[model samples]
Target chain A: MAYVSEKKEKGIAVLSTATSIIVPAILGVSLIFTMGYSSGLIYIIGAPYQLMSLFEGIIAGTLVFSFAGYIIGSGKTYRLFAGLAFGVAMFFTVYYIIHSVDYVVPNGLLTVCSFIITGAFLPVSQLATVIYHGRFLRGLAVPAGISVISIIVIAELAILYEDSGQSNLAQIVTLMNSVTLVALILMLFVLISRKSSGTGRIQN
Target chain B: MGSGSLLKISVIIVVLMFIIIAFIPVASTSGVKTQGVQTVELESDSGTRTPIKHVINIYLENHSFDNLFGIYPFDSYTSNASLSANLSVPLNLLSNRTARDMLTEIPSGTFSTKDPNEGYVSYHLDFNHGKLNGFLNGSGPQGLTYYSAAQEAPQWDIAEQYGLADNFYAPCLSESAPHHLYYVAGYSPIINDYGPPPYIPYSQSIFGELSKYNISYGVYLNNTAYRCASWDFLYGHTDYSSHLQSWNSFLNETSDGTLPSVSYFFSQGTGKSMGPPNIILNGEMLLLYVIDAIEKSPIWNSTAIFITFDGFGGYYDQVVPPVMDGVQLGLRIPLMVISPYAKEDYISNTQMLVTSILGFIDYNWEMPALNKMVDDSYLPLDFFNFSDCRTPIEFSPSAGFPVPSNIHFSLVTNTSADNYSSLFPMEPQIPLDKLGYNRTGSSSVNLSSMGVGILNKDEHGYTPFFESVGFYSMLVVLEIAIAAAIITRYRRK
Candidate 1:
């Protein structure tokens, strides 16, 4: 906050961060869901020439907000930056998977579910190394594992929705899908119990 | 400012410039997004029907004049003044379509035709180099045998009584769609449509025009018969169902004398679904069938049967195809017109395509409403002997040998000095390992979706899972790792 107030350049950084990281994550998700049946739609809509506006704007916005956050509270250095990047990458992947399913990914209900999985999976996976081994990014492992499980559950949902107008993801067509959902549910239970004492740093 | 800090400012400036350049567009287009490319829509190649009759046309798939005629036993057939001065020129004769598999590389003896089961990952014009952008190379038994040429031959022989063109050639060197487009339309721009697919539509085709005159046309395919989308547009616009024939229904054609003015018959898709190895002979057989039909039909002199291949199977031909867009389309393919009006021992050098067939129909019947893509392209006038108009004469179909599967049609080598040092990449020397088309079963024998000759030597054939977003994301990860290390070091200090 002080940096942006003290220097004009800091404000520009905030704008850059929003432009670069935030926009693509959102549009990329939206397109993935819509381009289901007409897979070929990727060619014209995401044309190379059009990238001038898409990817650039995203990186700019990401730079601004992220750099501003870094300066606040004794400068976050690289740990926070990496956490955010992993989270965004996870969101992008989820968006792509839903979009490529070759069928409409349901408007309100399915969309919300997809976002949840994206939000949970990425950080859990990246921080796994740190968590088990008691290292730098240990906090991220939980979110990363959760993201993997979420993909399975969501994939089951997408396929179920395609097969029937309404899908119960628990009824999986493949053994793998069912196994992932079961594991994620159990993992989520353990995580919630461990966090009940409010001793974990992840919340902050 | 001190030079030390000046460098940092410049670095910041460059990074900001790159980000700004990116943002200006990304921020603006955040509202818009797309999935894939859209195919082109244009007039189809189907022709219109009219009264005045006699039409003759021909198509050849991959064999170039030199590849087919270089070893032709012409001395025994036509003893000319010179030992064989002009024999290599295209002959409109009824000869065997089987030739020895051409070499995979340009110069003969330098490369083998034996295909490596490298998966599509390795399948490129050349594997070692990073360029897997163009077409697949195959050694003979002319990899040109996709359609059931042998099955259609009897029908074509009967129709050729009116005319035959010995000097026609393929417009491009690449594959099935481009050649088919060239045959039906004037230019093969459909191949160069770098945008979305369905580049040309049937509504813009010759068949589309023929529908205007109520002339019927049908293209029966099997499965998602992967070729030009124009085929679908034509079939769909003409109110014909594109029945996907199973292996058993391969020959189940319901078209009798009710056959449309232009009826295209193929085994559908590629490989085992097309029936046995005998399927490669479809082009020859279809022509014979057309010939038989014309002999039995009320419109004998008024019909034309075309037999052409989609592309050269990355094999070598001695001759140089005419250049388009600074790239060579490969050598001249062997095109034979089996018509009585076709001058015997006559060789014409006029370049032609599928559209010219429609153009011939337009000129003969004076149908002004033929699809313009075909009508718009220059007709292959030089190949036809226009000096005299003669009545139809019937010729007996000579029984050719049971068409051979093994033959050699070697590609000529690159002796050019600037092979690699040129401004851009050119076809490299054929790898010595690819000798013959021994990999006949290289393609999926039965499955329509499975393609044979999957080369995995280079990254060109297959898209890495880490392409696009994966690549950039990894770069971002690296930057984050660096920042993390810097922060950790600061904490320790």
Candidate 2:
């Protein structure tokens, strides 16, 4: 009788985990599409520029969520480092692919890719972290906090550079790249320190 | 899970979305006041005037006064004398007096393959504190370039027949986007920018005024992505969306004689003769089609067409624009007023701007001024003397003109006689050419043999492609994607 209740509790936890991630992913994707459509992308011929930026955000979010999930689910220091490294590599690769392409990929293909990445991969990865850790908000919070801070800092630097009469296009680009690199290094250091201290690792 | 939790989650999401949307700054329609102040009165031979029932504003893209209308034959007595006399006082001056002599500088058949840079910063640099000679040394390759006499033959022909405002200028020194915003709304606060984000709200516009009076108005766009149609302010408001229709709807209405009291026509952004990268001849042909439709319609007698360009697209013009309230007026642009009441072969040397159209609309409809700036500017009613509405003006459409083969070319190496012939075709030979005007100087270019290209087949090429797979398809795709996502989520559960 105790064993049956234990199995039921595990099942209920899995269901709860699935519900949490799936609902948010669906809501996020739907909100993004609605915003794009209502913003006059419906009348435009090809994919509106706004959708492309939204796609980049989804790609970055999926990478962070999945990497965090793998690190938390494994509950090992080495896995945490490995996952962080993989996340960084994937983020840069996706960014390079999006920026360097000369020809436009069809909007439909882009939409489908974005939807699959956000809806399927995001939920599955988030569910892993949620099930093992009983909550994944801490893991999610770290990356979200980092992203928000980096974006705000980058935006401020850009605005300041624009306001400065002496700054030119090349100088601004260089400044942004330097700031991004420094931010990346700082984030990696934080992740390494947390892993070494065994602060985020789950105990069996 | 229980249905109660699902309901709570949905409600929470809905409330959150509402909160975010509510913070997005809705445009206040309360602040704008209509002060009934009459600025300019029309001077006409007859004391009584025929009521103008319809006003059609057709806005074209980039071309300067000296570039398009430099060589247009002007009556020196009326244009020069009136402008000189009017300059003593604060009356609007005509174009012929303001424009610099380009007879020696720009050759008869000059052509360029390169497009000039006409960004906000570039325009400011080119202005050079109103010296106006910095075009050549400015940011772009074709900044100093002007359309030759041969290149401007089509527009010149129209100007000769209709009422042309030689001294008309763009209201602001900016790119197409801001200029377009200024066209519908007397003021555009968001200057020097483009895009879907930072959508402007409908706080101030001629449309809002028209709505108050219950006057009918429609904005017809050739391309959906044109700056005016893509304006977030209009799209965001449900009240104005129905009034925004396709360009074809305008044509159909003209044919059916069902056009609204006030109609605005915006050309396609590219390949429709908007200049720079696109061929200029394509734009002329589009204008011709609109004119032909209007001329053929029964509403021709009652309708008045105000054709003008939005701003100078980095073209060389010798005139230094006047400063108004710390902002330098943009360079001189070509303005033509076509109506039964428009003076025949008459050049009105009045200084006009995009605001003139709004002023005329306000005057005819007995509506209040859009704002103080518009109220101060000269109205275009001076272009028309309603003493002669009994006889309509006759316009011969330029038929069988060969469309330019190359849509894109550089100014340096694109000196083909064939490309030049597209502007001045020999077929249905131009009346000006018959009246001893040699369009092709020394070059022997045959226009009859040259085959029509993409432009002749369709003025706006592949425009139907968007119409065929339009908003419906977009919605369908959205619906399918959502359904698939929902199904996938359920299967995962």
Candidate 3:
């Protein structure tokens, strides 16, 4: 029974960690690919443009996050399954964006900016995990670094807005910021609850 | 508080945030503001007059106003013009409508879609008594497709720099033939594209009227000088055949200062029309060439160039056509007035038709009106500012993207086999010296509430939390402390 409980805790840690890292990476790469394809910076044929970018982003993101997971000492099998599950979750997240999010500018800069900003969730989640492990400064550093990167991204979006007067694109920006903030708070809550419940430490 | 108490409160707060996020709609952002008034006052101009001597009408093929300019200056990622510089607000997909509402009624259009069904009868079905919801049934989803400013760089650039008429309707609710007839004559006897012998029995025409007053007019066709033969066939008169000129002649005339008092240019043959096998890139290129030629000419100061489509070509437009004189008006088509006297970044909401061109001509030359409709039609004088002659704004001809090898047309041709470039010879290039000016400057402009002319601060400010550098700096300090703690813990492990 002790062994089973330990195995369950390990599984949960691997699953949550992989999900926190991989999903946002997929979304980030997807937005980049989409921006490139729409701007005519990238050439692709034979499939629908949006679908092709999404598929390519998933593959690239999966490969990248898998390496990161491996470096972090996660089990190979756990990382693989978690990657697949989170990839599917990211696909649905993009689908929701397509169906629900409106006010697309011709250049598609707004949608890409929003999704890239929402990608802050990855670092925020990492920060929570590190804090729960009693490495408060290290965890705080991760989000701080991400925040600086986000500022640069937002500055570019602001320049684009100034040039275009495309206030409509702001809808996606607001929606994405709200999602990222909520997810950050929720991740912290989940981590705090786990620590208070005397849950075993995440196996690094 | 104990860690357990802190955890409980955090969970509750997180849940509430998620619920709030879920309920927030994506369309809660600011939208384009429009005025309810019909006309707008120009920045420093009070009275209207005309400096237009040469009237040039460059007529292209089918496309509705909404099909091309649904978002107008905001159609592309770049704002082409300012809202303030624009005297009048245009009615587009973004006007008074949320993005969700737009997606529900008429989803955003895509590029490379098949051209939709368009004709006299089909247009009425699409009209659906002004509900404007019968596009799917009347012409299929293809009709609902619209081009972004990225795809229509030339049109958007010209409209933003000059004047765009959003409420200009086609004189007839039919295809190219009748609309063409309405252009030369104030009216069309037939409702559709085709009819019996003497397709247009209306002996009276704007061309004949010009000939009667000996005002000098030319019909320049782009394909070949020979296609002008159709003019005789359509009108049953060879009287104006002498006035028929080739595209090359038209360009040469602009520079030679021998351009006719009135000129009607058609790009039907050179694939410059925006119909089936819709090659908008070629159309844009053709327009740039024409504008470059005109702007460089001796007649540039005296010329007022009107660029418009002959018909809507079965694209989705939300506004229903109004009825007049027991005949229903046609779909809304885009109209741009380009001249030194033309209003800058202005949108004219004035209800107008093709006959308005005749009205302008009559008003300009002090000639009698062509007919009652021409007499009643609103003159395009409102689109010009006689008080101040704005210098000719140089527009870049670069499409800013690689042109597609070809655009496919599923309606009229076999898409798999018909490549536009391969089928037609490359358009003849005008001499660089003839253009007289080098194309410079980026196509984008800084747009505020009222576009380029007025510099109002943007109404939608940047995200507050994201733009706070101070907050981010604190976060960086916090992050550094956490990283050192992490290293210490790892060393112990």
Candidate 4:
């Protein structure tokens, strides 16, 4: 019976995430594909990089969903953490795959940089979008927002200096992970403090 | 507006700042070219130009050059980046930006533009042999492995029965998939959908044609071994047979042929196929079994077996795998073509592998070796110096005494993970538990402390494999620790 319920929960989460990413992905791809028809108009309207941003949005949205599913998934101790780790790792793996392709056109170096940016964009967007959904994760929101902003700052600087090296992107992601960990810790500390500080209400 | 939110934002900012700080060094190397990609075409000896009738390919894992971290005895562990630097070999190996227009034909006797500084540093044979021998005696250094010669580890005749392709290498000396692809396709691409539902054909595979012709191929697997399994498309469909066998039994059974014309065999988990082999000598033993077959089979006459690896598994090596066709070959994985016709004391300075396998078939059968093979040739048979005229010849098997130790190579280790005390004494190195791993019908146990691997061999050497936890645990442990510490600290106020 528990197994059945667990399966159901997983199914629903999958359905929801798919529904979310698929709709936007389709719309984004369509928007992207249509712009090719009017290259001049698309370029004028900033559609060239919009496609990149939309992808970032989708990744962010997906990561938020994964986070929610984990916190809500119940069962076991750290399903959410597992999911987050997996989702991010998978996200980066995809980026590595893009960077690895040999036959990429335009310029291999540029392609690699684009992939790194695209990868960074996803995590940033996820935190930005998910922070609000955490339902006043209260003080947690501040740390989360700063984390994203910091990443963008780093990214901008990296691009300014040059974003072609593998380590630049790697360092950025590694910092993001570390900060995220720190923020989560801080939020947990705040939550426990609140619970014990004479307020007899559980925030969840 | 809240201080909490401000704090959170500040932390994020700090993290990003650190990333930028870390990236300063990387950005400093701007405009540094990453070398160039190559497409090699080796020439075959003309006099004994018999078409390829039989080809056997073997893929061993993680055991680059030598088992340990040295190329000679008593050498220390090294940090060669050939096996697994995570950097895509194509980008890291070839300078596409600078050498985009330059078309330099690959010279013969060299595999890729091999940088002698990119792979895992391997200890010499003396180190490997001495270690294994000592470990088996239970009197060795007890370093990493205890797979001494006396451990009854499966042994086979290499270097002697086959003309050793000394300069042969793994496509990339690393992970399973890319190397496997190179084992069959010659080139390893960075694919998006690399895992699951093996038959999902996002790209071209040579096995497609082999399957189309009913040439006969099979994957002897355990676990969910069929990821990105398009190799089945080459044969109408693929079969997962030989699912369960004792390591000893499988070795004994498989060396004599109970199979098809083109068979793809891999052991599960720790039993050789999916391990770094510093722990279990599964990969080496498995190769030995294949060697045993070629050394004592009727098919040995007309048969040739090529052994190579796929990608460098983010380790290290000195010989950077070459770029064949377009993809980075990864690193100098060990490659050997076993046959009577192969060079006796041969050191083939050639970049040949899966594509070469396809090249062999394509040249002999008049088929187009897809992907890289289309551009490359079956690693030219020059590794086999055919000074005299010869037609396609076939050899008979099981003719000799077939001693297992004719060319003995045993595994040993002094710093077994069971006790890396000499290395990291401050770290509590309890034999960590390898949880949830087992073979078919075997009870699960903690593999870490058990002095065994993912598949612990029993007295008779029958072992089952289990699903790897992957990196799922590290995150969990960290999460729990931080959660606990944070909760305690906040409550203290």
Report the C-alpha lDDT of model 4 over A37-67, residue by residue, as the tens digit. Answer: 1111111111122235433543453334434
lDDT of 1 by residue, A68-124 (tens): 322221233244445556456545564565556421222232334233333322232
lDDT of each: 0.34, 0.50, 0.52, 0.35
For model 2, the stretches where C-alpha displacement exceeds 4 angstroms are A1-204, B1-50, B74-113, B139-141, B195-200, B225-235, B390-493
Better of 1 and 4 by lDDT: 4
Q: What TM-score does candidate 4 reach?
A: 0.40
What tens digits encode model 4's per-residue C-alpha lDDT throughout B373-413? 33443344554534422222212123222123422234333
lDDT at B242 for candidate 3? 74
In terms of lDDT, which candidate is stronger, 1 or 2?
2
Clash count per candidate: 158, 13, 16, 85
Better of 3 and 4 by lDDT: 3
* Candidate 3 per-residue lDDT over residues B1-493, each given as its tens digit: 3334433554454455446435432222221111111122223311112677799998888888877887654532443233322323478776746421443222222224566665554565577667777777655677776665545555665775677888889886666666776777666654444222223321356665565555777888854444431253243344445778888789889989999988998877566565655656566656776887788889999999988988888787777888765557888999989988776556777788887887777667656566656666777766776766656665532423222222221222222332221111111132213332221111111111112121111112122232222222232223222322332232233
lDDT of 1 by residue, B86-115 (tens): 222333222433322322212311111232
Off by over 4 Å in 1: A1-204, B1-70, B73-169, B185-198, B212-216, B220-230, B233-257, B267-283, B324-328, B365-377, B382-493
Output the lDDT of residue A160, model 3: 53
lDDT, candidate 3, residue B127?
Answer: 70
Query: If candidate 1 were superposed on the true structure by all CA atoms, what would the RMSD be?
Result: 18.7
lDDT of 1: 0.34
When 2 and 3 are scored with TM-score, the better candidate is 2
The TM-score values for the models, in the order shown, are 0.43, 0.53, 0.49, 0.40
